[model samples]
Target: MAARAKREGVSPGELKGRLLAEGYAQRDHPGIVFRGPWHDRRAALAEGPDVWEVASRLRELDGPEEHRIAVLCEETALHPRHVRIAIDYAAEHLDEVLERIERNEEAAKRSRRAVQRRAALFAAVPDPGGRPRA
Candidate 1:
């Protein structure tokens, strides 16, 4: 915070107040009081608080902005036509529904490696230990 304030040429008090008003947490010490989608684990990660963007897009859907599934799909940045798709997938793959898409492709790479290692261990008829077997 001190570094940020200095860089922005503002006082910590001013910055903190604005952040608090914008739904960020307050801090007594100079550490993070919120978690986020970025490096700071303390800054709050924004989910679907994009009501303004959602409402704007919902205006393009049928009738009023309060339409049921269409409005909800729009609010979540999902296509209106994708609503039924989501419904079916939710029924099938509900366990993974809340996974955030912003997690980098690198993380998926890590998971793939882990799954491969587990499969190798299960195979047990080991050729070499370090890399994948043919």
Candidate 2:
């Protein structure tokens, strides 16, 4: 953080806070955080929380945005026609939407890993996966 703060002309605390707000987590050491790209496209869509939740879950669907939106609306119990505006908006901002979804998925994976790590530590169980234990 000191190195990054020196490069960015900000204090280390400021850098750490900024990184934490941007979904970064510590790497190598407790205070050392890794910075990565984040796309916050939710504000651009102007949809309700339900719509956002549905849209986030659509990342795993392999198809065009329209098809994904249709499936998402059906699964979320939202009217498909009512969310057409959001779907059209998403189509226009496809790249940003995809980036946002990818970032969300990456964050979820990190969260799962953290939970598993904590559980393993609590249980005193070594990793049982084929890969070498950390």
Candidate 3:
């Protein structure tokens, strides 16, 4: 969709705006999708890209204890104010927040598994490109 937007000489946000103006409706996902003619379409788009990024980063940091928004802002290079926005947004959409957390956890698990596999392989085999046995 981004590529399409780029080719069309418009930012993704602009493309969405055009779609909304043309009666496009949002579907399951962060961005918009064309499912059918807009029905009771919203007058304006919800959150922007920055808010989405902040929310996603917050979700990735999910764990036993809550983290400071300042720390998250530092990690994501987002303004501290966006933290409040994300928190408010999450409060209103608990299910989506939970889904994001679950998705992030699954991704982390996959990454750890890949690292372990690579470590095992490297441990079992010496570097073939290194200086030949002397």
Q: What is the C-alpha lDDT of each candidate?
A: 0.45, 0.56, 0.55
Candidate 3 collision pairs: none
Please, what are the lDDT tens digits per residue for candidate 1 over residues 1-134? 98887776668897677566444222321121333432222222133322222332333467753375666764576655444433333334333322322243457789999999988886766456655455
* Residue-level lDDT tens digits of model 3 in 2-102: 99788777788987786764442233222322222233222112433333345666656755324667678567565555466555555655675566566
Worst 10 residues of 2 by lDDT: 25-34
What does candidate 2's lDDT look like per residue over 1-134, in tens digits?
Answer: 69878887778997778666434222211222222322221422223442234456666687987788788777766566645644554455477556667777799999999999997876665456744455
Q: Which pairs of residues clash in candidate 2, taking residues 3 or more apart in a chain or in different chains?
A: none
Query: Candidate 3: where is the Cα deviation over 4 Å?
Result: 1-67, 74-77, 126-134
Question: So what's the TM-score on candidate 2?
Answer: 0.48
Clash counts per candidate, in order, are 6, 0, 0
Best by lDDT: 2
lDDT (0-100) at residue 69 of candidate 1?
A: 60
- lDDT (Cα, 0-100) at 52 in candidate 2: 35
